[model samples]
Target: MSDIEMIRAARARIAGNLRRTPLLSAPALDAIAGRRVLLKAECLQVTGSFKARGGWSAVSAIAPEVRARGVIAFSSGNHAQGVAHAAREHGVPAVILMPQDAPKAKIDGTRALGAEVVLFDRERDDRDAMGAALAEERGLTLIKPFDDALVVAGQGTLGLELAEQANEHGVTSAEVLVCCGGGGLSSGVALALEAEAPGLRVRTCEPEGFDDVARSLAAGEIRRNDRLSGSICDAIVTPQPGNLTFPILRRLCGPGLAVSEDEVLRAMALAFRHLRVVIEPGGAVSLAAALFRPEALTGETAIAVATGGNVDAALYARALSTLE
Candidate 1:
């Protein structure tokens, strides 16, 4: 787990390289929810997701000599692009192990960033084992998607930004809805909010079948998803809560909420139509919770972090069709 000090340092380290994504307001969302809802459009961040923060933080923290040896990461998509992008910026080699079924855009994006792409079957192969073997064979550093302190600290920078932006918007208290996978972003933001925006409460949101974080919180222990091969929210389909992220979430975040696949699709379309933002299904989960599960929140001010925008054409088209 990461503390506020680590997050502050990460913010300083990556400040020059990252975009300060805006805190946006949408009247349509407000009308639907009947409250002040702010959207933290992290979908606009570098590599079209917040994963860049963690990737940069981990890569930049590496010793110059170690970085020369290269880095490795296993992700569904966003984190692969993030690590690849960060490695590219530092002139370091990156080898990414990704699911064979990961979004084509993400696979191409990672390759375009100059990383060696290794794809494995999600149903039969173990990504972690493959990544570890490759790292050992090549003397590469494994940058985990959500379980590292460096990555979590880096992700917490969003919480710092959110606190500052909410203050600027005159929001003293709010319920922040973050799409949860293995709890990297949610737990990191939870820690940051606990220190910086004490008035803001963190809530993890997930697709209905993949709501391990929510279930874990409710059960007072870490929980695992029964199956990982079914969700359209590929960006957040981890099998279980991360070892490091789970404790932070359990301590700092409130009971989580979940939304159906249809709700996630509707939220994606709503983001495009009302907020004028392109969002993936996983990225739209928090927004779905905000729009459809308002009763789960307790504050007058609500903010949802739209975490990514890397949807494939087919899924984006389907989401767009929801409005029609």
Candidate 2:
């Protein structure tokens, strides 16, 4: 649904508001992957994830009068913080509907950013229904986490940066692995690369049981995950790929890749130990696939997007202990 032009405009609109996260590599990582590995360190981006790009893009694109009326979104954690932060910066009110079971750090972080937090049960409550009710009551604009055009356009900016950075590193051709949930980030990046760096292809990465995008890609249609709450990689879990995002992914992306929970923890540990960057489980899936599923990759080089670093302290400590 998002074109390169919209992505470029998003980059322009969100300029100076988000970090141009770097592409990092460590010899240790390369050794594990058995190929040249480049990690797009989006974990270091504002709000500790790449979600800020879409948040800013969606919120800023709202008409000033409408924006002042406020904005609302539903996210487990990363997207909540992103939307909350953007709303705070624009002096607008934000109400975020977050899963009651989301990491405490994310809920607290969203509140710290000045958004009103509403908690809902992931399984029983329909977040979409709740959000719509709230939006109507408060006159709040809904900024969908991944399904909206502007949000997808905003996420596409990451692909633009990746294209430029890959060129700088002499990586004209490589598989760019992205941690995917409802396909927003992956689809956006796929579109951007299709236009800017046709040689750099995108591959959707997910935790094993929740490989909806991967299954959908293989099936040539959207597929829904049977369950949503079990994976430690909660940040990237969703019911299915976005209707808007799946077509782009099916059109442009390579086969989807899935990694186990153990692989995800190990990838997080490896990221901290080797890259000196902290990565949450959901954010580490791309790196997990690159490191542990090398046989599934076709390219001589791999670029994995480390999407977030919002892990709870205890969970982080547990991940680090795995290496010990």
Highest-lDDT candidate:
2
Q: Each candidate's TM vs. the true structure?
A: 0.98, 0.99
| Cα displacement (Å) at residue 46, model 1 | 0.5
Each model's backbone clash number: 0, 0
Off by over 4 Å in 1: none
Candidate 1 backbone collisions, by pair: none
Instruction: Give the lowest summed-lDDT range of ten residues in model 1.
Output: 293-302
lDDT of 2: 0.95
Give Cα-based local distance difference scores for all models.
Answer: 0.92, 0.95
Error of 2 at 71 (Å): 0.5
Model 2 steric clash pairs? none
- Write candidate 2's Cα lDDT for 185-281 as tens digits: 9999999999999999999999999999999999999899999898889899999999999999999999999999989999999999998999999
